[model samples]
Target: MKNASAINGYEMFVIQMLFSGAAAGFIYPTFLIRSTEGAYWIPIAVWIAGALLSSWLYSRMLARLEDNKLIVVIRSSLGTIWASILCLPALLFLFGALIVMLRAYSEIITMTMLPTTPISFLNGMLLAPASLALAGMMPIVRAARVFFLLALTCTLALLILGFSDIDWTLGTPLLRTNGDFLLDKHFYAGSFLWMGFTITSLIGSYRMQSARRAWKSYVIALFCALPFIAGYVYLPIMTFGRELSQRLTFPFVSKMDSIYHYWVVFENMTAIFVSVTMLYVLLIMALQLHALGETIKSLMPRAKTGLIYVIIFIVVYSVATYLSSWRAVEQIVFITVGIRLYMMFVFPLLGMAVLAFAQRRGGKGNEI
Candidate 1:
């Protein structure tokens, strides 16, 4: 593993973009399409604003701890018992996310390209990320840079192609929103798409990286990802209309399958779409696994780190491999909505509070 000092804000940006692409393509659009009767952009706008606020607060918290990383500061300030208690939800959210994504993509591959393939063999894709996560952050960052270029280029091309047959009429109710999605669970379930900052924050030791630089990287990446998220939702609605788009499980995949441009050489756009998305998924999985492993190590500092990662890989792989259906994956996402929200909105504020209290106590002791 290269030193943590070698990691930088740009690397974090690439990692965030990878996470956004991975979530945006497969499951998120369906939730957004179903969440509101008004313009799909309303829910998206609301969520993007919320994501920016959450990331800003998180960056400020990191800024306050100029000398130590979040995990180390939390451990010293809150004590091991309290820090473990605080981070329990983070652990749950990461683990649940990993399972949902692994199974969801595995199901997609089965339905789209490999009807007769065993799901167990498909889930084995996690093995690559698991090995990289165990190797550490720099390795993951290096891998993410490569995947980002390939995945981004292919995804943008698909989105452009999506514009070919879209009917502007089907996109009616463009500026309307009644805040109906506020009551819908699925709206909140789509939070995974905007959680790049939270995921990167868990990678300890920013070292020489500043909070300002990190926040800038995150915001830029978020804007860069806007089209993917917007295209994934609106393209399908424009192509098939709202009523039909919501009914489809993987709307973007269906959209890809429907495209018939002669200039496009690939006979099966679905296969190409899935292949590129797999690259995004693998890198994001490594990020999640690394975050989960880091949290566990902080909580149990004496435990063997390799053993922790190995056990994590086994449990996640086994559960994901045996998942019965796509419905089950969605159910898991629904169940974790509360955890994800707390991680996004509440966790950073709580961490900041703890840090402030710690700093005050340290000041008093110094004065004494």
Candidate 2:
């Protein structure tokens, strides 16, 4: 090899996109957002199906390119003329989603937990770390790994602390079928959380160095994800029956407080636990910002990509800051996901078919 770069582009791309890509902070909130709309069960089930379809699409995108995040893959194979066109919509949607998360999360803190604190203070408090992390992708990823572990441990603690108190009787007879309206609601809610994982396949382009790099990564990733998914699923089932679970926002947080521990230091352990969990969410947003920066630099070399990242950062925070409450943020979240469905689904199929064509032509396709 003639002098490989210090941070291989693939690794760099992966590092930036990995921390938050899989978790998809903006997209995951859609479950709650859609839940607010009243379909209750259908949206969740649709979401679960979406995750499966997304996984297939993701795998195909992986087949389309050797490495680099989706943005790079598009530019390389599709050509900048076409790629840039495709990219514009992505930037607005993804960037908008990021803002929605910022606003919603900040509101969650101020409204639910810190009623006395000013919104500006809450936004600044959260933005400082996100800004610091976005400035350096590598350190931010490392921090995310640490935060992931901490979040995992805290989740386990929550399970142990709260499980016994959950009245098993309360959730009995999980009506295999909610009424016509509610059945639709349940499916979409289930799927909404999984939909955020689509970015993993996009970023997995870089993480998966080879078809057979290591089994451990898959195991570890799966293990980590199960707890996160199960915990969310568990809280709604254990805390509120299907009917009430459908009605609540932040069901997990409500259940945490319902578990009474007289000796426990805080009466509202949910707020503390939830606050910590938001750090995990911040790690996700930082990663996306970094990926956007790297992708812009790779494709549009004349423009300073960091400046683009800064502009995006400003846009996301500005929109978030202007949003007065979490409810408005929630509406934006679902609509975004609904809009992404078409692109997210179609892009992978196109990439896969073209890549297959490239492979048949001996792994060459108008290399950028």
Candidate 3:
């Protein structure tokens, strides 16, 4: 493990800690979007429920294993080969998620922001930033903190503006006429992104400080997440209602276009919002990419971590870029993230149990 200079002060760590949670939350909107195969909130509602379950497991992991990282906890308690094997789903999901996010964001940028720019060139633009982020995990995390704030601002701006352009009458239809198609698809696929919160549980805490302000960090996490849910799901439901929100490709931006501030100089505010959103999503993707890359590198010290990270970014994003159809991408998300989240729930719970046993065996003198 890199000698982590523990981020000091509970409050500072509290702020930093919550960013992950917030970052996790931001992915939900994208998750809901990609997973939005049927109905309105069914999948999302399931996702939120699963997320809360993950949160419960997270606290268990934190409480029982005071010192070990998630990878170590898994390898030691679950057996290295088995744990590593289990990690495949997460690795694939992480890689796929990052790839898909980049492509989707680039697509969003192309569609909304840089209409004239070719996707190939726009995708290439992500390299430097992604590389720079992967090169230094801490710095990327720090950058994420800033980006999280910016993303939040943009989301709020979206809510304020969404009301302007969106036709409120769209909410009129039955929320979901179904008992069947909605149940089968929306409940199953739509909530894939809410699994983003699992990052906090899976990656383990990097910048550990005194556990004094843990509650504060938890509070911050909840605070960060609620607004994100609001932005991705709540705002859309409010603005476009059940009928139109499911139809819109980029519902957030679509809502943004409805409201206009004639005095505002920018011709397309959706473009600006998307760019800001992309930056935030990029920060998150970089962090997850770095975390997994770092963990694997820690296990294999001889490898150049930077090169590995770059390779990973390229490979995943390339596949994402290749995903030509929206449906294909959505289905992939269901399989990948759904599988990752299943492991997230299982291994973390197992780790917590084993750590608790280990702690009892050691008589609590040392948690590591």
- Candidate lDDT values, in order: 0.88, 0.54, 0.57
Query: Which residue pairs clash within candidate 1?
Result: none
Scored by TM-score, the top model is: 1
**Candidate 2 lDDT score relative to the true structure:** 0.54
Top-lDDT candidate index: 1
lDDT of 1 by residue, 1-368 (tens): 45443457688678788888899998999999999999888888898899999999888888887646688789989899999899999999998999999999999999999999999999999999999999888888888887788888999988898899989999879898889999998898898888888987877755325677778888988998887888998888899988899899999899999999887888898999999998999989988999999888977889999999999999999989877888888998999999999999899999999989998999999999
Residues 206-244 of candidate 2: C-alpha lDDT, one tens digit per residue: 434431222223323433455455455455556676566
Q: Tell me the spans in candidate 2 whose CA falls farther than 4 Å from its real position.
A: 1-49, 129-136, 178-192, 195-197, 200-224, 240-244, 356-368
Q: Write the per-residue lDDT of candidate 3 for residues 98-202, one digit (tens) a residue.
A: 666667667767666678886667667567556755656456656656666566566666566665544545433326534453434434543444454455444
83: Cα error in model 2, Å: 0.8
> With candidate 3 superimposed using the best TM-score fit, by how many Å does residue 297's alpha carbon deviate from the native?
2.3
Q: Model 3 clash pairs?
A: 164-258, 164-259, 165-258, 165-259
Task: Give the 10-residue window scoring lowest on summed lDDT in candidate 1.
Answer: 1-10
